[model samples]
Target: MKNLSLTPFFILLCLSFVKAQEVDISGKWTGNSYFLGTQIFTEYELHQEGNSVIGFGTTKNGSDSSKFRLVGEIKGQKIFLKGVEYVYKVGKGCLSKAEFTYSNSGSMATINGRWKGTMELTTCPPGVAGRVDLFHKKELMVAEPVAQSGTSPQMLQSIHKDDFEGTELVNALADRKYYALIIAVEDYNSPDIQDLDNPAHDAVSLSKTLNEHYTFEKENTLLLHNPNRSEIITAFDELASKVKERDNLLIFYAGHGIWDERLQQGFWLPSDATLDSKAQWLSNSTIRDYVGGIDSKHTLLITDACFSGSIFKERAVFNNSKAILEMYKLPSRRAMTSGALKTVPDKSVFIQYLNKNLARNTHPLLSAEQLFQSFKVAVINNSPNGQVPQYGPIGQVGDEGGDFIFLKRGSR
Candidate 1:
């Protein structure tokens, strides 16, 4: 997509800048290469003749491994290489090209670049490309797991990556387990308030979609239907206590919302909420507090309700085409609402498009902003009243401009 390159992401490596006739890219390079959203541990043994470069490297994912040859040149500050013909991977004839910018923090040289995966082979993962970040072998902080090299074939086909040990599961730039809090209130106790139809049904649909295709697991996802105010608060409290700083959190709500003009406040009506009393209603500010309190790398709140847009403080901005690695570096608190202080229908066009898009995405990493951009305009055009969906940073929620990344299953 756009002008960026794509790579099959099967093979690649790194190294130290040795002293030579030119800026040398020789020696053993060790680091991580992100391809197809999988973090492949790589090592390169390279030799340079003037500006020309030649190398062979190995990439390991979970227990899978493969070898390939590299050929490229030193072009000023960037090194360009093509990983062609997977020697051990069974694939023949393809170019997994990468352009890396060379930099040094003191004596520690680092190369980071984008990949362009050309499908010359029979099988090439299309859609989105990944990033490669390598440091000199000296910069490696921990040792990666190495199989007997015979397990590559079977490892490549396995859906689970539990074979990778230690904290590799929590690598911010790679794959990790995602936690979710799903709250949907369809049956309100108040006779004065009209009951809704899609909240519980939509929640079930979303929960299944997330657990089946994305990084979210059944154990990690908490679902509550027709929950009262206390139960809703308890769920947040439990997540705040359990979620670690490196993990990500997604909170989804499908229910009725009200905007009080006199008080300038927005509230989510719980199952126990009465029309005459505001005590049982959940305020947007309280939700904000919980969002900010959770020690997660990224927190994305998806609300399908009237006046749900009140959570947003200012418009969020991030280049969709930016490297996924770059986006994962910071922390974020963001929300995507059904509408901006406007009444939405019981049958939502918002959640409809959201589900369709999530299931259809083929890329390894899908960011929150990317997900919203895919369906916001469509929902507006298709809605009966032309409801405008809102997306932005949640106010005072410690948003450091990071985005919530949805890692599709089997990517790692």
Candidate 2:
């Protein structure tokens, strides 16, 4: 007879092995890794076989870059890897270590860990210490696709103010160009909310005005009707792709909007947004982020929807619009909302006044500040509910006492 002992150490080891086998980490992991004040795009292509894993990490910046072979093992919920970092600057390898704790909830996968090593970049001295304490996630971790409505808006055509050629003062404004993205969502997929009137019509009317009156190249004016949340985001992304640092960008939206009283946040409801499915709603903070990411010298957001005022409460720059020449020298980010966190009628008195004022004004260049102030007075006088408009510069959003000048005849 042979005597066999089942020790506690062996029991724990078996449990760890079982846990590691239950979870699969056999895919790509990507994130931004920062070291020595430089951001490095990192990607790890990993393969898991039993409890052992092997992979490679590729990092690059401009012409400086390197790749490393990674070897690691999974124990319970933790992952440990070791490698040698080959620096482009030093032309030699240095020791590196990474430890991570991973989790997956259905399709959403995330891994957070700490990495320490030596990395020498072309911008750094020699033997620069590198440390990355961050999290990586599976790519394209977007929410489930929302139902789309209407046909996809056509891509904006590139337009240039070639009228500048051979004109005397055209040389003065030659360095500047104008771009506009106008969106209107008048219908909804959700039955809980009723469809609105005048959004799509208003967007069309505004687009025509911008193109004909403001010298916005008809090709460059992008007008979208009844766009989904993703389409709205993509519209901005496309606009950003084409604009330059010296250009001015204008965005206008007219649709259903909601405000979270508990969270003190506002959201722009897309055509597919449902009361039950909150993820379909686009937050104002996200719009702010997108507006900030644009490279244009001046950006203005005009919204005619409920809770639009909430977007600027915290980020309002109180300065008045500056002189034309001085304003052109500085940057500006401003907004004019229809109303605050209250119900806004579908008739859209805000845009009505805006259209009337801009159309009738004889000013060669109507500043955004002037348009906002005029609308505030007109909306209060006309709306039975006294839905006063809100206007201000976006705080911390690169407003520098400048104004968005809408050129009436393309010359000032």
Candidate 3:
């Protein structure tokens, strides 16, 4: 019958039916492993060399010296490994094992089986093979993908800054008038402070940077070094009065923050001030009240300090107090702090992210929400122990509208 061409046709069909599988397990993998129903987690990096795979795994205790190797062959859709060795450390003694497995899928394989092995003790004896399910995914080659386009012109103009020139981001956002007031307080005069050599800490250099990098409206930007409590109060009072007539306002503060349990409040310590004596000099409530009193439709308060929660309580009290009612009624306000209320300020990292991402535009562009999200991610990523940076709207005055851009086209 078709013997004249059957062999060639069959061979061609088989070759055409062979499909290549895609493997993508690369970089770092974080997952938990179970041994005898007890779970242990591993964050490992897998590297593939020809037909063999090798990598090191790190446990929660920060131990990562253990090495593992797997040698396998891929035949069509099946994979087979003859010798697989894993060596690791436990409480005292070291554990080592060699096993073999027949896998069904090369690209994606899961093995669920029992293993019986011998323990290395003085009287070594065979141990029961506990159940194990090892899951393997093919390694993938990865590269940083390009950012998507179609962003607004304002977003496109955002600058990128490291810690050294972070003030630029605030200026960039402020140029668009997205921010109403930008106040930076660096304590360069403190006797105990030693890092003042940084240009960021110098009042003159910082002010010059702000002036050259940003276009500020008259009386909108203030860069002070070790100002007294009275100066801060006066500035807030003046800024509040001016912003009460506008539709939106943005306020930013960077300095040392201290929490006093006795007063049940937090205070921003100026350069010349001490937490031991001036606990009441510049209370968080004072600033909150001033910002809360603005008649603007939207108000954003960004503070890089500790005990920021104390500001909300003060804002609430200020809204209900008679002091603010004489000049202006309270408006919607949103607040964000760089760290927990009792935590220390992450000044360099916080301001660096703000300056780098907020400044690329000549016009007001980024919404307060978007900027805060980016800042939060950056801070958390750079922080130790993966500590989460906390942020949320503080009081009832913040719910009128959700979107507030720091820069807008018109004068307030």
Best by lDDT: 1
Q: Which has the higher lDDT value, candidate number 1 or candidate number 2? A: 1
Pairs with steric clashes in candidate 2:
315-395
- What Cα-based lDDT does every candidate model obtain? 0.77, 0.73, 0.49
- Model 1 lDDT, residue 98, Cα: 79
What candidate 2 gets wrong by more than 4 Å, as runs, is 1-171, 315-321, 410-412
Which residue runs of candidate 3 sit more than 4 Å off their true CA positions?
1-179, 188-219, 309-331, 345-347, 361-364, 385-387, 396-403, 408-412
Greater TM-score among 1 and 2 belongs to: 1
Candidate that beats the other on lDDT, 1 or 3, i.e. the better one: 1
RMSD of each: 16.7, 24.4, 20.9
Better of 2 and 3 by TM-score: 2
lDDT: the better of candidates 2 and 3: 2
Local accuracy of candidate 3 as per-residue lDDT tens digits, 1-412:
6896798898877775554233323334454434466554534444444445444444343343333333444443333332234433334222323232424375554444333445554211466334434566443434434556964323223223222112222332342332245555564345653322232353343334334444444455665545667777776777656653334666666666777888787787666665346733577666666766666556767776656556663332122212211111233467766666556434456656666555443533445556566667777788653434454455544444344455432211
Ranking by lDDT: 1, 2, 3
- All candidates: TM-score: 0.62, 0.58, 0.45
